[model samples]
Target: MTDRPTDLSSPPTPQPVRRSLLSARKFALMASVVAGLGAGLYGFSPAPDHFNVLSTAAHAQVNNEVRKVAQPVGFADIVERVKPWVISVKVNINEKVAKNDDSAEDSPFQPGSPMERFFRRFGGPDGMPPGLRGGRGGRGAVTGQGSGFFISDDGYAVTNNHVVDGADKVEVTTDDGRTFKAKVIGTDPRTDLALIKVEGGNNFPFAKLAEGKPRIGDWVLAVGNPFGLGGTVTAGIVSASGRDIGNGPYDDFIQIDAPVNKGNSGGPAFDTAGEVMGVNTAIYSPSGGSVGIAFSIPASTVKTVVAQLKDKGSVSRGWIGVQIQPVTQEIADSLGLKKADGALVAEPQADGPAAKAGIQSGDVITGVNDQPVKDARELARTIGGFAPGNSVKLTVIHKGQDKVVNLTLGQLPNTIEAKADVDRGDRGDATRGSDIPRLGLTLAPAGSVAGAGKDGVVVTEVDPKSPAAERGFKEGDVILEVAGKSVASPSEVREVLAAAKTENKNSVLIRVRSGGSSRFVAVPLAKG
Candidate 1:
């Protein structure tokens, strides 16, 4: 035991410990080499051929080509050329003065006068005290600014009708700081266009109208005075064409994605070639600022309206007097039409061109001068493009027969008389109809219902989900005719329905009268 204690101070077994340390170092070195080899392979190896390498390269090249084609290089040259012809239109409106004898006791604004309401709504002008308004006699000058462009070398300019309307004095300022008094040559409110001329200048710089319409996605340059900042230039592409903003009957507007503001109205929207493609008229903005949605009058419409305004100081549009509605799919099916196209003639005026040309109610106008009309609005615009007293041919479908009619157009009237309301007397007694239930309608003689006349069959009850109800038939509606035949009793409706079924028809046209107006409704024979 003593000998073993003595040996504890010496170093123990060096050979076995050194061999174990060497084995641990060798394991770590081998692991580092394997990791380095794996990283090198991952970083330096080529992509496999089966991984669609060729297709990926092809897609990259195509995308690069598309980027090159779509991106515009510069618009400075176009802006510089078109900016000279653009002008700023300033108008001074002289408001009528109300007579006020007493300045201290009487307020200049009456209790319910427009000026009083205006002050209440928007405060006094320039933040002036309301009491001081009485001494001014309610007379004030309103200043308005807009944009326009020269159309002729003799200083004829084109702008919007709303720009200089009711203006006492109009002044136009060019890009070169020259200002001149301008006079209105003419205005067309229907098209929202105006023509004006400057007297003191000749050989002035002018812009040319584009020969063709700009296609969708074509680059456009809009130069205008936005928010009174003169000669502001913006660039965008044509977003759409033939847009209707419900402004007027001739509402074919070219929609663009340009940053247009309040003072940009009546400015010119130029094409890449520096030609005037459209006249900027309105913007579809929610915050009273540009949201990249703007509308312009197309060059085609501008050209025609300008020519008329220059010639006669007014625009005279052709009129074929007929009340029209859209041809629905149900209507087309009832009339045996292959597609739902054209305008349905709801009514022809008594002595108008349509009546003289033998056009009748329920006829569909399919074409004008052999050009296919897409809808009622298209037919209206097409006819309006022609001059009054021009002879035109109309292709119409009457009683399921296609016919051509020649008509000499008349001048469109400035005012159209509203349809008079039919006076309905009290109904007498109740008369019940047979319980057929196929059309899901309960009918009776018009005389049976209160305030229903004796001319047509009255709809007494209608199922909520029925075909007749789906076609907009109500409980008080009176069926005036079925398939152009007058129906005085419920039996006539059944007769027409039975005849349509025999002819393998899916729907039938029924003329219904509700309140004071009458319209044609096609009811489907299918059940829900």
Candidate 2:
């Protein structure tokens, strides 16, 4: 190749240096970074707008988690803070002998000799389980251990109804180790709350109910006895709220992941602020241990029940006598609702509140006194809080437009009562119909089912393995009608089924309200 340096002398001009085509890319990236910083600084949202954004924290980018931090209450401090008021409940109930009488088996308590056996037979517990007590020999004390806390300094404490049900003698043990005789003043089974008073207590440690919306992922604590281990404390966040565990009508449970178990019933669920937001009551456990599905009854529910118990020594529900169901997406769509929203009025009592206000079946209630009804539980809680003759404005989803109806909520007859009053319907079987009847059924009132307003038939029982049982009939499932016949009680379902038996039918058209949604199902009827 010929040397070009020879021409360099003549040209004496510098050649232009080559540059990368990607140089613009670097500048663009820097510009983007700067613009991002500027936008963020100037209040431009940095979040990706999303539906689920409500559930996550925005500071997660920096690994900063959203924590529920209360006003720094210590475990013993909280125990010392709320303990003298915290109480232990002891319940006693004669274990019912199954109707299909079976001979008492060989039990440890059986007399060792004929004389002992005779003595045992003489003093056998009247209502006692096998082996626990000498048969008819002595009165048995069914010891049930659970939790509670005082709301007032005058010795008023609150616990779950399950804690006090069938209690012959309730002895409340305080943190100070003083056990006093406690008696249930009033119990609202709908809310699973009971008001109890202990003798010889004053200036007791008490906790005030916290009032606010619970934040998901907020640091919270549960204090109670677990497995009979007293003064146990567990921490977690709010997993959910207003959760209906099919427990009762007033089922606005504050769902948390805190470890609560068999003996932790009726403990307080405290926020970081040391305020009682809920009462620890339940867990979704498949193995009798904490499975991160613990639930608490919210303080709002507590407040209502407490006021009722204090004023009347019983809960007096404001009844707008009307039957209603949850407005499911399907029913909402049928009614032209944008979302499966509000409570659908299925039936109304002739002289109940809704009927007096001229409310009718098919009116979807969206709110009570401006409180929006998101589900049947919301409606039930709302109605439950009202006293008889207390007028409330109920928003109805009628046809399409939201209509406001002024109804003076009235007190319903105590014919139907809190599940605690049911005397035989508070346990797990209270949730299924078959538990009540052989088809594996149990029964509850329609209004009691979702706590939604109702004036129609309540389907409370369906037998397991029965044609109705196999088709998913549950205890809380409110039977609206059977084969076009209106039903209002478990007795009605029995009557309708009995009548259907006479007819040659393989299936019966059953209209029921489940999870607030009303639907018709062709339940298999017993073959004639």
Candidate 3:
């Protein structure tokens, strides 16, 4: 009776929540329909080509460009062109051996002896008898093999000097198995290049030397008779230029990676264009086989040396009588130079061209005929490039002053003895001095030290960290001259140092003698 009044005035009764449940089959069917719709949507969706078209197009363009500028896929064409010019050189060397006074039966080390067998078992190939081991001794002809290339149409070929040097007879075999007797036209040992001619052939296939320098990384083909394997071809790229392997005084060489081996020496290294870029000469290998590091005589050097060999039987280089050393930064500082460059004259021969031109020790050769000399080796090469009797203007710095001196170069002697005459001056009274902390040196008269002569001041003590020590000055070194002025006492050295300071110079050039040898050293002045 009160429900109508309570609902109107207070609260109403709560209603029950309603729940709907489906059958398992119907739920599975509904899930399957939803998945099918998702699959169809995904399958019918357009590909991402609209967004990736630019990148794909860019990649395709790059590939097309690469196809146009790629390197040669094969060197077959180059090999075919250059193989005909390559030849195998066989040489017969007639080496004379001194007759042994002892008979084979009397000798303990002769072939078939007990010592020979012992050595053969223990020493490997080196222990075998000279005769049995194919060594060059006794009264028989020794055979050698090398490679070369025809340089001219008349069968003029180029090869290493060592290959045909002192050969009793020389033979050349072409790629087609044609062999001919070759006459050695000339050989230059300095350059290790030789010229030989085959009189029987005319209009023969030949290779042309490239006029331009081969750039590093340029593809190269090495065609030669490696290990007596005729017409063998190997390819690589130029590894470096202007390499020096100390083969000789003129050691400028082109380095390549063309798999050169024993018989490959004296063969031509051709560019991809089939032009001779260099002549293979040496290989750097620890196992006596190819390690990919090889050296070649540059085409420019070959051209010059070959032309000279053909014209004259020898190579003549200009010589100036001076023993030179590189101008180090310390030496340059001591000489008051702006930079450490050029060659420093360590000694001038008494009657040599440099001495005749008044060039003396402690002079820095800065230039030859206005061309800058980089170092001692460059100076040697520049001078050697000139012919004897040619007059060259040398720009030299002496006592911190640049001077031009003209001198006629003399022919280089076959044997040059670079000996410097030490100036053993008269002995003087002993003198003492306290340590000069700036130079980190303690000095005394040379005569004060027992066996030290009196021509200069002896360095008694040297601070290991001083500028003097940094410039290679050491105790027992005798300072013969300071700033080109001879000093016989510590007082003289002090006087020269004071004078250099007065002149506001940063360094002082000193001539030092140690171990019976003398050299010029530039020592920097300690800052105040």
Candidate 4:
């Protein structure tokens, strides 16, 4: 379209420009350039608040993505699915039975302490339930309560062995408020696991043990009866795995940060999939309350122990019959080993499987069935996993040579008695053995000491400031061997020490017998 501009009056009204000073396209372009320049200056300025505004938006986007994958909304659904399998275990013991049961005093508090009395008042001395501390002329029943869960549909349940260890009557209360009489089928004190059969029920809700071990930081739910309060549920993450808390030989426990109290023993710790990851057994609490650090027997251990308890009324563990110790770094160096990994044989039991198979003192057990043992504890656990009479190959470092020995496993006895004092035969002159000046020991023939055996030299005296004393040598300790050689007198010990020194050995390994037990000690040699 063409614009018509015609004016002749009043100087043509300044001739009202026939065209605008700038075209519409040029005006829009110039406005955009000015706006962009202002924005660039605002962004490049040293303003923390402005930068934080942009940073917060970026962080918000990242957090939204992370929350969608890593975090769970809640554990309610998992808890609901697993709670039905949890139950409360109650035991009634005759006063006579409770008195004879040593496990009845298995309290978290020290024996005879005031805290023990206080905790025992509510629960029994075992931290389960009520019991009679002392009463006159009456044999009243001592009642205890704990927690457990069904493991099969035929009313078979699992509980802590200590719960019904010597019970006269056992009762279980389910989540649905129904009570059933239960009989203890078998108990394993080593793992502290027990199997029981509930009467009056053929179909019971049971827990499925997790096929896979729970990983650290995985979410877990602990359900149990705490202080007679049944069906309590707590949520937390798996804090750690394969923990050894000095409970027993098999102390591989799964630690969780869930709040588990005294009465929660034997209850299952469930994973997000509603599978039992472990059984809540103990708490590391000083006040007998849930301090958020609790221990659970792994489901793998429970399954193994419960299976045996169900098949047989007693659990039998394979034993090699040897007193063992850790292969410390010093011991490793003394034995010419590259790594401090294995079990050092302190002494093999007389006529036992290991001794019968020619295993000797100071041998290091490095592996079983080609599986490397991490330490002395691992050796004990590996051997115990097998049944009695099972033959296996043991990789032993015997006399600085690696050899495999095949030995039949023996059954672990219920009570491992201390060996009797050896009848050492005749006496020798006390002055026959010379003093070991380097070790700061005054030696005498073991036969010279009135009650000491004749196998080695006796420590007549030990200088407190000497290397021997520092290595735990004391009077009455018999030195059985020095540098892998049997030492019968002080001269024999001196010869071995001289040989080790000439060989430039850093330390000499000595097997000593003290308090009816034997152990190997690596003593550092004095430098010239």
Instruction: Please give the RMSD to the true structure for each candidate, in Å.
Output: 16.3, 18.0, 17.3, 14.0
TM-score of each: 0.72, 0.59, 0.68, 0.77
Off by over 4 Å in 3: 1-72, 96-141, 418-482, 487-519, 522-528
Off by over 4 Å in 1: 1-72, 95-141, 420-479, 489-491, 512-519
lDDT of each: 0.77, 0.64, 0.76, 0.80
Best by TM-score: 4
**Could you give candidate 1's per-residue lDDT for residues 171-221 as a string of tens digits?**
899999899999999987677689999879888899999989899999988
Best-performing candidate as measured by lDDT: 4
Q: Which lDDT value does model 2 have at 91?
A: 54
Per-residue error (Å), model 1, residue 181: 1.9
Residue 239 in candidate 1, Cα distance off native in Å: 1.2
Q: Tens digits of per-residue lDDT for model 2 on 1-528?
A: 343345544643222211221233344445556657867889774455432342233223212211222124446565456544456555544442333233432221223432234223332233111112212312433455788888988899899875676566677787767788877899865666799998986888788999887888887888876666667778889998777665556667788998776677888888877789898765655444667777788887788789889888998888888766777654554455688777777767677778878776667788877777887667876787778888888888665677788877788676642232222244433344323242345665555544433644444555556765666666456667765578766677777777766765455555666665555455554332
Superior candidate under TM-score, 1 versus 2? 1
Query: Candidate 1's C-alpha lDDT?
Result: 0.77
